[model samples]
Target: MYRNNKSNLKLMRLLPRIGVICCIALLLTAAGCSRVEKAEKDDKILIGLSLDSIVVERWQRELEILVATVNELDAEIDVQIANESIDKQTEQIQYLIDKNVDVLIVVPNDANAFYDVLSEAERSGIDVIAYDRLIMHPDVDLYVSFDNVEIGRGISQRLIDELKKKTVNIPEEEIKPFKLLIINGDPKDNNSKLLNEGIYASLQEYIDAGFVTVVDEAWANEWREKIAKDLVEKYLSSGEEIDGIIAANDVLATGAIEILSKWRKAGEVLVVSQDAELSACQRIVEKTQLATAYKPIYDLASTTAKIAVSMAKGEKIIANDSIYNGYDNIPYLKLDAYVVDLDNMDNVIVKSGFHRKEDIYRNINNGK
Candidate 1:
C-alpha cells in the first residue's frame, strides 16, 4: 500500500511537469506570432525619389518640398537626380529597386522608359507614384499633378488678355491674325505634352476663326535653352513675321528673349512663360517677359508626405474621384497653379518672398 501511494504521487508530479511544458510551448508560439505582427506593422517604409533633371529651377523646389514632407512624415526616403538622361533615370530606378524601397516616386525622363522598374515594384507589392510627369502605363498606382490642361489654357488666356491691354493702332476689323511663335517644352514630358494640348485647344478657337496665325511651332528637345536659342535663331533667319512668343516654361521664355534681344525686341514681342522662377518674375517686372504659372510646390510635397506616412503605417488613404492616367482612371489629387503677371507680380511672387525687388532692378538700372 505504501509503494502504491508513492507511485500515485510520482504520477501526479509527472502530470504537473507535462502541463508546464505544454504551457511553455504555447507561450513561445504566441510570442513568435506577436513578433511577426509587430514587425509587419513597424517596418520602415523606404521611399525612393527619382528626379529626371536637376538643371531646372522648378525641379529643385519640388525636391525640397517632397524631401521635407517625407521626412516630416517619419518615413525614410532616398532621392536621386538623373540630370535629364533617360538611361540614367532607368539605372537609378533599378538601383532603388535593388535597395528594396517600399514606394517609388518618379518624375520620369521619358513617359514610357521606366515601366520595367514599375513592373518589378508592382510584382513585389510596392507602390509607385508618378510625380509631375505622367507615367503612361498599365501598372502605375497613383498620380499627383496640377491640372495641366488648365495650366496651359490659363497661360494662353492670360497672354490673350495681356495683348488686348497693349497699344493697338489697327482697327478691330483690320486686325490680322495675332502672330504667335511657340517654344514648346520637351516633347517627351507628359506635362509639357498636356500643356501643348492646352495651347492648341485654346488657340484653335482663334485659329479656326482666323484671328490667330501660328508663325512657328517648335518643340524643344529636353527643353534645353541652347536648343530653344538655336531654333529661335533659325526661325529669325527664315524671316517669318513673328509677333508674340508663348514659351512653355521660364527657361524657354528666357531663351526666346535672348534671341529676340539679338533682334532688339522688347515691347514688340510679348512672351509667355511659367515657373515664376526668380528670374522669370524679375523679367516680368522689368517688362522683358509677360507672365508665369506659379505652381505651389509646398502644397504638392506636403500632400505626398502625408500619403507616404499613411502608407508606411499600413493605413488606408482616401481616394479622390479617379483620374485617367492614360490607360485607366486611378485615385489621385491635383493642385491648382496661379498665373502671375506684372500687375500682380509684386503681390504674387515678390511679396510671397520668392524674389527681391533690389535684385530684379539692379541690372536694368545700371544698363549693363
Candidate 2:
C-alpha cells in the first residue's frame, strides 16, 4: 500500500506537466494548420503569357488589356515576348513550365513548334490556352481569337467592291481585269494560312471569270514591313502594274503604301488590310488605304484573361466552337471582326475607344 501510494503521488505530480506539454503541442499544431489555411487563402493564381512578339502596335494594346483584366481578377501573370523567334519562344515556354504556372497562354510564333513542351505542361496538370494564334498541339486546352477567315473575306470583298465601283460606268467585258498583288503574313502563322484561304476563296470567282488577276502573291517572313516593302519594290521595279493590294495586316499595308507613295500611286491604288492599326485607320481617312478589318482587342484580351483565370481555378469553360489543330479538335472561342472604312470609322474604332478620333485623323487635320 505504501509503495502504491508513493507511485500514485509521483504520477499525479507529473500529470499537470504532461498536460501542459500536451496543450503546448496542440496549440502549435493549431497554429500550423491556421498558417497553412491562411497561405492557401492568400495564394493567387499564376498565369503564364508567352507572346510571339509585341512588335505590332495592337499586341501591346492587347497586353495592357490582358494585364488589367488579370489584375482585376486578383490573379497574377508572367509575360514573356519571344520577338518572333521560335527557339527563344520555346525557351521561354520551358521557363514558364518550370515555374509551374497554373495556366499558360501562348501566342505562338509558329503553330507547330510547341508540341513537346506543351505536352509536358499538360503532363504536369497545367491548363494551356492558345491566344490569337493557334498552337498545333492537341493538348492545348483552349483557343481564343478573332474570326480571321472572315476578316480575310471581308477585306477582300471590300477591295472587290471598290474595284467594281471604279468601273461601274464601263461595260463589264470592256473593263480590263484588275491586277492584284497579295502581301500575306508570316507563312508559319496558322491565322495567316486561314486568312489566305479566305482571300483566295473570295477572289476565286472573280479570277475564274477573268475579272481579276493575282499579279504576284508573296509571303512576308515574320510579317516584317521591310520584307513586304522589298517585295513591293521588286514588283514595281519589274514594271508590273498593281491595280490593288490585299495586305495581310496593317504592317504589311504600311510597307506596300510606302512603296506606292514613292511611285506617287498611294491614293490611286486601292489597298485593304486587317488589324485596324492607327496608321491604317489614318490611311483610310487620308484616302491612301481603302479599309482595315477591325478585330476588337478589348473583347479578345478580356475574354482570354477571364478564361485563363477560370481555368486556373479549375472551373468549367464553355466554348461555342472547336478547331482542329492537326492533332485533335480543341475548344475555340472566336470573336467577330468588322471592316473599318471612312464611312464607319468613327462608329467602329472611335466609338469603341480603340483609337481617338483626333489621333486617327491627325495628319488629315494638320493638312487641312
Candidate 3:
C-alpha cells in the first residue's frame, strides 16, 4: 500500500505537464493547416481577358496565342469578346471583376468609355493591362503594342514609292498631280490618330512640292468595311480622278478596293494597306494592293501572355519604353512595323513563318 501511494503521487505530478504539451501541439497543427491552405490558393491564378472584338483576324490570332501561353504557364483564363460594343464590353468587365480574377487584360473598343469600370477593377485589387489598344485610364498598369507612328510612315512611304514607279509610263507634261484619298480609322481609337499623323508626316514633303494632291480625308467608323466602302464610293462617283489611296488597315483597304475594283484590276489605282492579314496577302500577290504593313502577331501575342502571367505573380517586368496616356507615362512595350511587298514578301513574311508559303502564293502562277 505504501509503494502504491508513492507511484500515484508521481503520476499526478506529470499529468499537468502532459496536458500542457497536448494543448501546444494542437495549436501548432491548426496554424500549419492554415498555411497549407494559403499555399494551395496561391498555386492557381485566374486571368480574365475582355477583348473588344475577335472579328478581326489579328484579335483571333491573339486569342489563340494567349490561350496557349496561359495554359503553358499552368494558369486558367476566361475569354470574353464584346463585338466592339462599349456597353457589352463594360458588362463583361464587371462580370470578370465579380468572379475575382487575379489579372484583367483588355483591348478596348472605345478608350474613353472604360474609365469608370477600370476604376472599379482597381478598387477590387485586380491589375489591368491594356493590350494593343491603350486604355486611356490612370488605373491601367501596362500597355503592349506595335509602334503606330512607324506603321503609318511605313505604309505611306511604300505607297508613295509605288506611285512614283507607276508614273514612269506617263509623259512629264501629261502626268498631272497624283490625287490621293485618305481613309482614316475610327476616330475614337488613339492608334488611328497616331497612324494618321505618321501618314501625313511621311507625305508632307510631297504635298509641299505639289507632287501629291489630297482629294479628301474621311474616317471609317469602327473600321467597318461597309462604312469605308460608302465613303470611298462617294468620292469615286464625285468625278474627281483618284490615282492612289492611303487606307488605314486591311479592312478599310478592302472596302476601298470594292469601289475601285474596275480600276484596280486594270492596274490604274494603287492602294496601300496594313495588318498583313491573309486576305491582304492574297491581294498583294494578285497585284490588287500595293503593300501591307506587317506587325508580327505571334511576337505581340506571346509577349503579352508572358507579361500578363508575370504581372499576376507579382514579378518584375522590363519595359523598353513609356508613353504618356493622358495622365502619366505608362510602361509600354512597343514593337516595330515592317512594310511587306512582292519584292521581299518571301524573305520577311514567308521565311519568317508568319504565313505559310502556300497560302500567300495560292493565287500566283509560280511559287516564286
The candidate that wins on TM-score is: 2
Q: Which is the leading candidate under lDDT?
A: 2
How many residue pairs collide in each prediction?
A: 0, 0, 0
* TM-score quality measure for candidate 2: 0.90
What is the full ranking by TM-score, best candidate first?
2, 3, 1
- lDDT for each of the candidates? 0.76, 0.87, 0.83
| Residue 59 lDDT in candidate 1 | 80
Write candidate 2's Cα lDDT for 1-368 as tens digits.
Answer: 11244335435544565576556556678566665445444567889999999989999999999999999999999999998888999999999989878789999999998889998876666778999999998678788998889988999999999998988799777999999999999999999999999899899999998989998888988888987788789888888888999999999999999999999989898999999999999999999999999998999999999988987665677588999999888888989999989999999999999999889989985733
**1-368, model 3: which lDDT tens digit per residue?**
01243235334534564575556556668566665444454456788999989988888888999999998988889999998899999999999988877779999998789899998887766778888888898767788899998899989998889778867888877767888988999988889988999999999999988789898888888998887678677876776688888889999998888888844432468888789998888888888888999998899888888888887766665578998889778888998889999887889898888899888888787655
Stretches of model 3 off by over 4 angstroms after superposition: 1-42, 167-175, 263-266, 366-368
> TM-score for every candidate vs. truth?
0.84, 0.90, 0.87
How well is each residue in 151-193 modelled by candidate 1, as lDDT tens digits?
8888888887766665377678877777888888888888888
Comparison by lDDT, 2 against 3, better one = 2
Candidate 1 local lDDT, residue 355: 64
Backbone clashes in model 1, listed as residue pairs? none
Q: Which pairs of residues clash in candidate 2, taking residues 3 or more apart in a chain or in different chains? A: none
